[model samples]
Target chain A: MGNLLEIKNLNVQFDIFGAHVQAVRGVSFELNVGETLAIVGESGSGKSVTSKAIMGLIPNPPGKITSGEIFFDGSDLVKYSQKQMQKIRGKDISMIFQDPMTALNPTMKIGKQIMEGLIKHQNLSKNEAKTKAAELLKLVGIPNPDKRLDEYPHQFSGGMRQRVVIAIALACNPKILIADEPTTALDVTIQAQILDLMRDIQKKTGTAIILITHDLGVVANLAQRVAVMYGGKIVETGTLEEIFYNPKHPYTWGLLSSMPKLHAKTDKLLAIPGTPPDLSDPPKGCPFAPRCPHAMKVCVDHMPDYTKLSATQKTACWLLDERAPKVDPPATIGVGGE
Target chain B: MDESREKLLQVKNLKKYFKVSRKDTLKAVDDVTFDVYKGETFGLVGESGCGKSTTGRTIIRLYEPTEGEVLFDGEEIGGKLSTKAKKNLSRRMQMIFQDPYASLNPRMMVKDIIAEGLDIHHLVKSDKERMDRVYHLLETVGLNREHANRYPHEFSGGQRQRIGIARALAVDPDFIIADEPISALDVSIQAQVVNLLQELQEQQGLTFLFIAHDLSMVKHISDRVGVMYLGNMAELAPSDELYDHPLHPYTQALLSAIPVADPKVERTRERIILQGDVPSPVDPPSGCRFRTRCPFAMEICAKARPKWHEAGKGHWVSCHLHDDGLKK
Candidate 1:
């Protein structure tokens, strides 16, 4: 499959008063056709910032894409103006936000909202748009689609509202769908339903999916490949098994061990100590060096480059250095997938 | 860990209904029953609007129970209690709120905020005594006395939760109801707070009624757990037993839906996806609340509410399939 989207050395910054917050620092990745790529990170780790930067949704003046190129359809989106980006956003790449209530207009009917994109991008008439909207709703597995199209945002449940939001995102058959924690706002059962529906949609449409979430479980559940971000940088990127089974970076290890599992009974979870580094004045060396358990003396003085583990896996960590002392993840910690 | 281990708190057929309109009653918590043993953590989990929080609030007498009994230490304290008795009850049972930022007063000093319980019951004789108590609590929850002068906004989410834990411990209560205590914190910080809770429970011999929507985290810390759906207890059993042998369809769905962090298991495992959202508690279904989303739903499920029974040893479940084993 061809690469649907490729981001190269992307840098994003926000100026809050006199201080500058480096939100995304040289983050790069690729999304291939019909493949799911999950970006996993904690808050302030720049996971959400990377997704927003891709959509050209970052507020300018305050938030700016300072450097790098976002290549989609063999073109750079970083230099694209607001008007040009609008066309690409709806027709080429669409995003489904975490909260459907905030994303959807409360007063408008569900059908009109779903049809707006179809009518505008596909050039369909009002009656034709209505027919397409119903099909979209049914595709997202909303029951009794014909009668439900007339309902408002509040009339539908949280899960149904999220389903409607997905329906809208798929209305134009966008090439790439960036779902920013799409199921985070819904319940677990509903989250499963949404995740299943998204997988079904991807299989049918062969759409490239970019799933952004803080939950490692969700990443495991959906993504074919995983990129673990920490302090605005892609610390580790690999196939799902590499990230889960043989994660090298201390940050990725900490994240995986921090979460308590369903099948395993462990006395204590290994929490990563300390908070994320301040983006206003980031650390001179590796940003995660402060909290890294396997951090070496050189980690504080210099940042490590990505070490290629395999064709699909690369990790940035001082522990990967040949000269550094060998250290392993704590014994009590487990993969505990089942 | 035995049958006669002593029930620290017994909630018998409790109900708490709010008057939404003059005629319409919002049944936030309907006839639910459970017991918290001494020094055991009892986890209550459900999705939003399932009355898990309401049950915790009602047990602490934050809201007056509309019906049924809440017996603590063999004394009924559900209805109209004397002010002195209520004040005494407050000292015996304290609550840790879900939102640390909103729970702590922004204008007040951390020391004063944590000592709010100390001053209420007149637990301290002098200012030095109160300060000493506050400082001791901070250290107990992994903070130092240096945090006494700061405000709630000064701390991060994890630190703020630690301060919240300190506030709850200042009263030296027998039972602490934590309402989604770690939900507000990030993943890295969640386990820290959970560890702290477990440590304090061991040190002080405290009984916890942990309320949260996260089933995985709840399963980690809870001794026994109860599954709630639309104001009713769908299942209740020991944590391991419940997770290992889930009988109720809702419980099975809830457990299966939790995404495992390992990709191999996630890809291979069969997930049970419920069909619809939780029905409105105001006009709940005639029988089981889960029948709307249950995969093994039968005609009898709608006809009558399934009787709560012990399907296996120490595992209680409410489902028509478990009502009585029969040829279908």
Candidate 2:
């Protein structure tokens, strides 16, 4: 249960034109051996950039990790050279992207596309990789793997294409899997199937998972720990129960209340007031001050420090400041219990 | 209620089939029937390629039906109507498309986009009147009057959707078919759009056919709901009744798949994970289209299509398991 990956004070910026767009600003978290950590946020949040930094996939010249130390299995990934990082990418750590249609090669057969990773990373023979490729397809629940493996990517449906993508990510038996919005483009029924498959695979293989999604429902059902991101910062970090039931940050409250639920009966949902902060030129004070319902005079002047709610929960909000008034979420949301 | 006031729009045995190949036919909307009461939201929920969108589009005559009738205000659309009668009918029915980015013309300004409908119907007399009406419509959807000069690219996804709503309201339509209006928006912005739609519906006394893929949002906005599967209506009931007591196996499976945000509730609820994928519409299986994945599927399910019958006072289901005319 020791830390498998620890990120400290991560800062990622992009040089758009002449100004620097600070996307990920001083974010930190830890992922244990076999636990699932979900990073939840809206579109422009830096959840994707932090994971991209770990995989060394950020395009340079415009993008740069200004400061941070990404420690993976007692080794610093930020300090690794391109050649060194290449060895660890697919062999030790794997990532599955959001859109499977664009991820897979449309012209190549499904079997060859999956076997390329095995051949390149594990140095398996042509015949050996082909046989193992079929096994991987079968493992991911694709029927008649032997016959379907030779078909091109366009022949498979959207859900099956995603399954093939999952099989590729699992081919090398990597210790960590980073899935970024794997079910965003899928239908709800297919999304449920994929979520179930990921959970089942994590249980069987004990692979530490980092699921990056905008879906709060997925985080509630899947992740052991949750990190709420806003304006490229971890505004809140806690277990699923603490984040959902007893959210301290106003942004987290907006997220929970904005989510359309099956049981809630109301004609108009309580939408958050304003848009996400512009990342190109972020505000000097609290990033979420404009949209926060409980904004104070001090909140507009200074950024809040991270306040620890418990050993496992911490939130960065001025309302959580000791001198600030004790503000609770709406009465209907209730406290952190059933 | 009387029959005239009970139904705002009634679609009977609606069919929109496409000739895929020389002999093969795709039943995109096969024998579907439903009614949208006046001033109520009728939700249609289904998976992709399940003909939910097709049904909505056909109702507005975007795709002409091969058979069946679409009656809006007690008059059959696409029937032998006089030229004046057709003109009056066009002003009463309108549709809001799925993608706001694609639905709005890129070249047109916000003012012109909203005025296009008014210009088509010649509802406005002068330039000043049209400009004032367009500005008023903008304010109605919570957009500022200054947005009239801007283009679609100038606004965010949510703002663009507000502009789309403004255009739909310009004609002053009585019935609106909102096809996944909030699906492309961000989660934070989705609530804003849904709330706006509900507010507008209430203020305008508009009948809506809200089509979406998410059951949670569907349950929030809809008064009555219909579940479609492979071009057929699988179940139809009141929103609260369907959520509490889902009868059809497909509907039960869909409801169970929705992930509740509470950990304790999620742990207590059992997820019904259906086996296999949805069959291709080009060559769907015989009888029940969901028989390939239905856990309670039987031999009769594969032999013939189940007859749509009322299982309760208002709840309707089309499955052989509940065809005995006995309420579950």
Candidate 3:
């Protein structure tokens, strides 16, 4: 499969009160054609910043892509002029936000919102756009698409609003879809429906997805490959099984063991101690070293290199070093009563 | 699981309705009943607009119930009471709000925020004693004493939640109503708060009415859980029984909807995606509230409300599918 989008050493910085906060620090990943890649992280981990950078949505004054290359298809999106990027944004690569209501214009009808992209990018006529809008709504599993097209956003339920947002994102049929916490604002059952719709659409359309979320359960259901981000850096990149079962970094182990399993009774969760790093004054060593249970003297002073574990697994942690102490993960790290 | 355990709080047929207009009334919580044991964590879980939060708020008397009764420590707290009795009830049953950012007053220092309860209850004798108690509370919630001088904005979300916990503990309440306490926090930080709550429960022997939308976490911490749907309780059972063998169709759908964080399990597990969104609470479906989206819904399910029946040792379910009389 050909690479659809590649982010090479991407770095994003925000200037506030004469201080530079490094939001995304030297992150690199690739999205294969028709594959779903999930970037999992907590709030302020810079997952959103990296996605916004890809879409040319970063504000220059406060937020800037300090260094990096966003390669879409064979061209670099970073070098593209505003005029050129505008043409490619919706037609080639589109994005969905966390909140559906904010993403949509409440004053406008749902049909015109979906058709706006069709008319702008594809240059379709008003009638052609209207027909396509209903088809898009139907594609996203909304019942009575023709009638729903005439209704305003406020008339729709939260889940329906999200489906309409998905319809708008899919209107142009972009090759790469970036969904940033698309289901965070929804209920669990509604979240399941939206995830199902995304999977079903991907199967029929073959559109590659870059799903950015903090929920590991959503990642397990959707992503083929996983990239774990912490304090604005990619700590680990692996296949789904590798990331979940044979996780290398301590941060990944902390995230897995901390979760309260549904089918089992655990007396205590192995919660990572301390808060996330402050980006304005980020740690000098590993971002996770402060919270890691097995931190070493070397880990506090230096950032380790990415140690390749398998054909598709790589992690950045000093514990993976050949000379470092071999420590087994806590027994609570496995999933689903394993 | 023992029947001999003392019930700390009893909520019987609690109904809270909000009048949206002159004619229309939104039944946020209607006819809900449950009991919380002396030192147990009773979890209330459901999707948004399912009335779990409203149920908690009603029990805490944040919202006046339209009907039904609430008895705390065997004393009726639903109707009007003396000023002294109301104050005592407020101290005994404190509430921990969900959003720490919005719950804490931004202008106040951490010391004053934690000591507000102490000052309001007149528990402290002097300013020195108040500061001492605040320092002790900060330490109890895993925060340092130095944090007492800081403000809410200076702390992280996790730290702010710790402050909130300290504030709740300052009054030394026996029963705390924590409504979605960990929902607004990050994943790693959520575990921190849950562990803190568990540790505090053990140390203080405090009862918790933990209301949240996260089923997995609820299962882990709750001794028993009540599943609500569209302003009605669907099922009530021990956490293990509810997760392992769910009886209500809505509960089954909800359990299956939660994506387990395991690729192998996710690939093989059969998911039951409930059709359509939760119906509006204002004009909820008749008979069984979940009948609109239930896969096994029968004609009688739409005609009559299913009686709450005990199917196992303590597992209670309200579903036509489980009602022996209806099944026959």
Candidate 4:
């Protein structure tokens, strides 16, 4: 299948106190049709900015896509105006947010909210939209769809509200769905349910998904391909097995070791010792050099080039260089980089 | 692990209810009982609105218990006490809150925030003594002496949590109740806080009632863990045993839902996705609170509440499925 979305050299910046902060710098990745791709990173790692820039949701004055090419359906979205972007947003590529409570309008009925998307995107009449909205609700696994349509957002629970949000996003049968931290606010069981629902929906509709989250477990469970982001760049990109089992980047090693695994018995988690860099005044070298345990002199002086390990896996790290010292990842790590 | 160790805190049938309205009452923590041994970490895990935090707060006497007994160091601490007695009890127990930004006082310097417990109990002889003690505590929590003079806002989320820990340890309490302390921090910073807590437990010989929703961290740090559902204890077992052989359906579902960092295991494992959201605590199910969402619920589950009984050595579970061969 052809590529559903292509983000080439995407750069996003934010203005803070007269200082320009580059939140996303030169991030590039592609998503094929009917595939699930996850963007994983920490708080200020620019994963969210890449998703926002794709949908033209980056605010003006402070937030701007300084440069990039976002090609979808053989068209560059960067040149599109607000009106053009709006027509393509829900119809071609829809987006869902982290918090379900705020995503929904409190005063509006859930039925009307779902119907509004259909009425706008499909240009359907009131009755047709309402009927289609009910079907969408049922597709997202909402019980009592007919009765739930009349209830307001306040009446629904947290997980149910997220399901309603998903229904709205899928109202127009968009080709790509961008979910940013979809289940961060939910409990584990509820998070599992929501993830299962999204996976099931993808199988039935073949809609490409851009799952933006920091949880590796979620990425492993749902995403077919994973991109690890750090310091506003894609530090590593690989299939789930390559990322989890054959990771090469030092930051990826640090991330994999830091998480407390449910199945493993470890006394202390290996914490990467240092904070993320200050984006307002970014440093010259790699963003993770200060915290990396295997840092060499070259990693301190300049950014590493992308080294391809296989046809589908690549990482940006000095440690992957052939001439570099044979410093293996600490023997403490459970998987990857033997 | 230390079965003969003295019980530092004992709660029996503890209940904390809030008057949501004139006609309705919210059972925040209902008929709960547990014992925290000296120098051992006891974990409490549950979903939101499941009353895990309320259980911790009630144990620390932050919320008044509606009906039950709390025995501290073998003395009943349930009813009213004298001013001196209450003040002394407060010194023996302290709390570490979840939100480091909101918990620390913005107006006060880091020293005063940590020394609030010392000031309340008249621990210091002079201003210099208090300052020295605060500086010493700053070093204990991996911060420097220079940070003692700064305000809470100056520190990051992980550093702010260190301040909260120093405050909880200022009065030199024997037991600490940490309520979701690391949930607010990032993934990379969470390990720092967890390691600090482990070091403190070893050096000070402190008992902890760690309350959080993250089961993996809870298992790593806790000696014994308790699973609560709808303000009631569903299962209680040692850390390894509970994870390896979960008896209750709710506990099994919870353990199965967490995603391991490994891709092979995560994809191969069978995840038990519960049907719907957790039921409201105010009007919980008739018999078993988890019957509404449990996969193996039976008719008797709605007839009577299952008694918490020992299914194996050191493994206690409250479930209709675990009620087996008792007719013998």
Q: Alpha-carbon error at A274 in model 1, in Å?
A: 1.3
Of the true interface contacts, the fraction found in model 3 is: 0.76
- iRMSD per model? 1.3, 1.8, 1.4, 2.7
Best by DockQ: 1
Give each model's whole-structure lDDT: 0.90, 0.89, 0.92, 0.90
Report per-prediction Cα RMSD to one decimal: 1.4, 1.9, 1.1, 1.7
Q: Each predicted complex: what DockQ? A: 0.78, 0.64, 0.75, 0.62
DockQ of 1: 0.78
Candidate 3 runs further than 4 Å off: A334-338
**Residue-by-residue lDDT tens digits, candidate 3, A1-338:** 98888889998999999999999999999999999999999999999999999999999889988888999878889888889989988888998889997988989999999999999999999999999999999999999999989999999999999999889999999999999999999999999999999999999999999999999999999999999999999999999888998898999999998888775678888888999999998888899998999999988889889999998999999998999999998886654424
| Candidate 3 chain B lowest-lDDT run of ten | B319-328
Better of 1 and 2 by TM-score: 1
TM-score order of candidates, best first?
3, 1, 4, 2
- Per-residue error at A51 for model 3, in Å? 0.3
Candidates in descending DockQ order: 1, 3, 2, 4
Per residue, candidate 3 scores C-alpha lDDT tens digits across B127-165 of 999999998999999999999988899989899999999
Q: Write the per-residue lDDT of candidate 4 for residues B1-328, one digit (tens) a residue.
A: 5578789999998999998988889998888888889999999999999899998888778888899999999998888778888899889999999999999999999988999999999999999999999999999999999998899989999999999999999999999999999999888899889989999999999999999999999999999999999899999999999999998999999999997777778767888889988988778889999999999888888989998888887788888788874321
Model 3 is docked with a DockQ of 0.75
Model 1 per-residue lDDT at A319: 85
Q: List, residue by residue over A178-207, the lDDT tens digit for candidate 4.
A: 999999999999999999999999999999
